[model samples]
Target: MAEFPRNDMATAQDWLRHAVAADAAGDVAVAEQGFLQALLLDAALVDARFGLGVTYFRSARYREAALELRAVMAAGSADAATGILLGKSLYLTGEFPESAKAFELALTSMPLQGDSLRCYARAKTYATMIAGNIADALADYPALAGAEAEPIETVIRDGFGLLSAYGHRDAAAALGQLLITENPDDVVQRHLNDAVAGRAIDHVPASYVEAHFDAFANGFDDKLVNVLGYRVPEQMAELVSRHRTAFDHVLDLGCGTGLAGAHLRPLAGELTGVDLSARMLEQARRRDVYDALTHAEALTHLAAHAATFDLVFAADTLIYFGRLDAVMAAVAEAMTPGGIFAASVETSMHDFEIMPSGRFAHADAYVMRLAEPYFELLERQATDIRLEANTPAKGALFVWRRR
Candidate 1:
């Protein structure tokens, strides 16, 4: 523990103890005051400054939190934990490129701490995802040294996991770090012990999803439906009403900017939406259609509220996952018994290759194979969703009832 001396008059020890006690009790106002008091008494009290920054962070005042945290760096005393929170705060307040700097600096600390390693790893993966380099993502892997790098490695693994979850790459590449450039000394770290080289998962991995959604968030809706002819949502809605009479809950997975939620309006008692992109979720939030909005990766959101929804809809969102197992399972987990799940996927029976234009297509067989386990296929139809740009795309709308 580092000794932070306040003034010769005030015992730094007493103020620090008070600050820590207040912070642990969730009395951040008291915590902030105590920390500031310490700082006032002793300007060199790095601990108190850090405690003050943390108070702002826990209160969600991220900008103010970052300012005080950054002061720690100026005082020449910093650690991985401070860096991680500060970096996260900076990123959340829309200082994206600056967030990257904070994360990198955290990594430079000798023997990376768990949180710091993970932050940097996430930053790198998101960087790639934002660039839309699906192929390059397949090859990038984090270098993990010890417990300190666990968080970073986790982010890297999750990024690759998302690529695999969405069927962006082959199973072999996903089972291990087969796709990443590596030396002989590198060890492959999978969350599972023997899930095969690319065992089917039940939910989309967090890293790839976070990056892909954020990267595509700005132009996502326009490009997918407008440029590519995405009509999955409307068609799915039509398929549902033709068969079932009522649905209590309607959820849009990867609900980008509420495009699907808008189509689901009439059919929904209440709509709940989730997406990996905060920006896209923000756009959806403005529509006033969905009852609740969450900025979480597709799988985690669905998994957290398992068996609570009556209807789950994913419109043309499955294309991002090369494998349907994890995401489908999440949908299954989230739906009530006898609940109906509707979704769309672009079809391709050929080799899983990124065309010169860079779009992925999966065969209908691949789609059915994944859904058969948890859902009874009630109706599936081929349809086109009219894009805002007036172009139509070919897609499959499948309605499945949970068994």
Candidate 2:
């Protein structure tokens, strides 16, 4: 009843074919048993071994699959095709370097084999991510060498550069390593990340905003006022009323449509506003609330004109920054000793701390952490800012004295 010649171990080959067919048809259990049956008869069967390994892989039994494929390689049956597949199995089990070695073997045998080449390239990329500068130092092999380097390699390198710079020496230095002097573009992407990271930000003025705000400028206030529940101006007025004698000049960071201006109109001896969106500034300009309007990266602009404000107010600007050190440090330098800094942030209770998400729902512990180094917390009022993108945005109003 065996599907083979009943001699010469022909049953092994027939069972292996049945396993492969059943596996292709997605009958994993039957395929696994058939592959096992084939291997029982012919212990030297590489096809049945590999088939069983793949079946374990499809069943999400990555450890078992890895064990089997590792045996295949140990048995010296790892050709280019089998080596690449085995490397993938190792990668699934989180053995990255071992996976890379397998991919390297496949690529070494068939250097231009498309699948092998791609897998090999990706394995190296994964190693770079885990190792950082250590990996870069060890990998003396130029990642993008030769005129024939694949376009995908550059993208992977750029992403690595961004991640590296975020935590590494500096993103700029990482970019230097990743830099392709041929036209040498891609600097802007790193700058964008740097800006978002609360590092030195280079403001790249976009013309799109001129048109964007040009269209929305007229009704901008009405939108924020009515739709967004933008009580920034109103809330600011209340804070200023309570601390009216604290400061003489106010620098409104990210002042949109002069909402802060109207609130501090009575308190500000002079008012200046900064925003990335020129269209938003255009709307703010109409209200005559600011003595000056500058289109610059908000913190850079603040740092350039430091110690000028008796009070520096930012409502909802901290959301863009994951860390508050740079902005708060700038505020400390920009304010006179004991100058008051009042602002609104998204705040939440997180393990008894104010976290970064204060722009939405964040730990109050992270909020307090941001406030501690730069300013002494005076008063904080928790309130709902308004619905944004169909969801309500929560906020906290804090008054601090710059230390």
Candidate 3:
């Protein structure tokens, strides 16, 4: 460890030197105390603030590290080291957009280091995933073009190769990376931060769903049925059939490639399918099951035609929604008196959580609570909605009757 020169008079500089020495010697608590003392002596000392921020980062206190580093930058004392640390701290704290900006600034100040490049790429990727901005996400990909040797790059390469063999590599890789990380705890913690901060949207963005399903339309059935063993359509159809054999009018919400539509076609006098993806609607159109297929979001399409349907089916679709209140209200408004709203959702212990897969899971009590005001719970059943990594994905199938 390197030692700093100390003044005999024990000024702020002396305190800073002692603090650095303590930090270098792995005495972070003592270093923190010394750094605070130095700051108290000379509040304008940039190095002391930076050192303190670094100490907090070393201790894995990312929020404090971000605060201290942000203060240092706000005070007009910016440097490559400070910017890199700030970016890393922000990324760890789940402020991805700000982290990207910090990394960009750091790159402008100095050449990209391997760690900084990895953090920058991850920040951009996360921001794109949250915002559903593919163009902006691709803009950052150029930065990673030469980052072939980085661990993240290696993971991404391997992920893409695997997904490519299965088809739809880009979308699959993005979703897969969230599930397959070197440190799942860190990724899960970031998702928790997103959920707690309300940074995770109530519903998965329409743009994201549209883009995903559009890209997936061609291979959707094969991937869902064969690869993932998705059986929600058949399961939900059976659940609805048990209650009623037929309906006057039916709405298939999120009717992705019309899997549910195919199952529910026999039960509907007039079946309408609505989805965010035009490509998905195109695929559904070819099925010739739905009388009408509209390219629109579920809630928006539901709200547009109120009291128009007796049965609304959303098989495996509600998993994209973190909060059920608004959607449930919309469904209630859209259905006729004594109408049935049938949906399936991934289950969780919490009221609702944004999972590492970027999907939302809801507790049974939470779903029921949201439906209480406008509808009555008719049926709820535990079932395997799909298979992930060859394991059953536990979920709940819900049927609600409009009050």
Candidate 4:
């Protein structure tokens, strides 16, 4: 084993060399530590900061990467490469407007790079659409059309159309039209069909959920609580408090940003959280609440730690699960006998339905029937989960004890 140099013994240049070598050798975590050590020795070492930023970018810690890269640029240490990376990090963190600006800056140096141009265009489109700025997004259509080949252009057009239609509350018709242009055997088209018809798909794709939350991670707390009026986490905490004041071990399933953990910390001797998004886990780590936080899919994490938790809570987490059978079974296996499980679901008339927003809604009967065999319902009630497009979104909250 090689002994690494201590921060006090090594100069910033020495640390920079080692960090660069480590990064090129694909030991990014080590490279990040090395870069941090270099920065400690010399705070203004541009190479050290840039190396750390790139390491964070590679690790998919986009928010951290963006902050570091922004600092590097503000200090006048930026180049085309740094600008490109900063743009990518911003885009990954859902800061689309800023991402577009960063990409555009990169283009000033590398003007003819197709990849940069495409990324810039995509960022602008997503920024406009997500902010509900339809006219601005449509205004760029002509330029976007000229940039891509026919097939890619058509997909982009349809994607924008779907976003526009969904914004206008006509998602079903727009989805149908998009599917008509797509190959019948395409998996996404099939999923769109199921979503449009209000039928549950086999299951929500893990990739989709991971990407969605990963992008939303940076602003998740503000977007959920302030912008969307989300309160499921607090509601779950309150419901659990009424039943049992304390738990030996608690699991926060899909614990995005540790919101539930913040509320449930007092009730738990040990708190563990799991989510599919690494970026979301990063945010949760900042809360300093959970004893352990794992970046893993919910069922996979539960299976690995079966029968370990006395209580499990998932606030607004089940929306990503189009079907509940497998997940419910997994939770049952993961819980100790008589363990409590509290969860929330968007309301649906059918047993389960996939909405145009790509979330699942479960009927009250569906939740009750599924859990009846393995758990006993302690409490179930209808509640307003959040505000969607200036309207309250109705949902059901339930607390069940494992049988």
Reference-based lDDT, each prediction: 0.66, 0.65, 0.78, 0.79
Q: Report RMSD for candidate 1.
A: 17.3
How high is the lDDT of residue 60 in model 3?
A: 72
lDDT of 1 by residue, 1-403 (tens): 2233345565765777788887887877878877887777787888888888888888767788899889998887888777778888775554544676787777677545565555555555554554565346434534532343444445555545443333334332442453244433322233221123334443334554555566667787787765656666666778887877577887888788887777788888888888777878877888888899988777788878878888888876776665677778888999999999888865566423221112344567777878889999998787664332122335577889998
Q: What order do candidates take by TM-score, descending? A: 4, 3, 1, 2
**Model 3, residue pairs in steric clash:** none
Worst 10 residues of 3 by lDDT: 160-169
- Backbone collision tally, model 1: 18
TM-score of each: 0.46, 0.45, 0.55, 0.57
Q: Give the TM-score of candidate 2.
A: 0.45
Candidate 2, poorest ten consecutive residues by summed lDDT: 351-360
Across residues 1-403, which tens digit of lDDT does each residue of candidate 3 receive? 3354355556788788889999989999989987898898899998999999999999777888999999999999889889899999987766767888888888886877677777777666655645655446555665663553345445444333333222333444454444446455443324433433345466666656766678879999998988778988989889988998789999999898998877898999999998888998888899888999998878888889989999999997888788888899899999999988899999899898765455788999999999999888889999998764334678999998889
Error of 1 at 98 (Å): 45
lDDT of 4 by residue, 304-394 (tens): 9878888999998888887799989999999999889999999989888777666788899988998899999999978999865334689
Worst 10 residues of 1 by lDDT: 186-195
C-alpha displacement of 154 in model 1, angstroms?
Answer: 33
Top-down lDDT ranking: 4, 3, 1, 2
Which candidate gets the maximum TM-score versus the true structure?
A: 4
The backbone clash count of each candidate, in order, is 18, 14, 0, 1
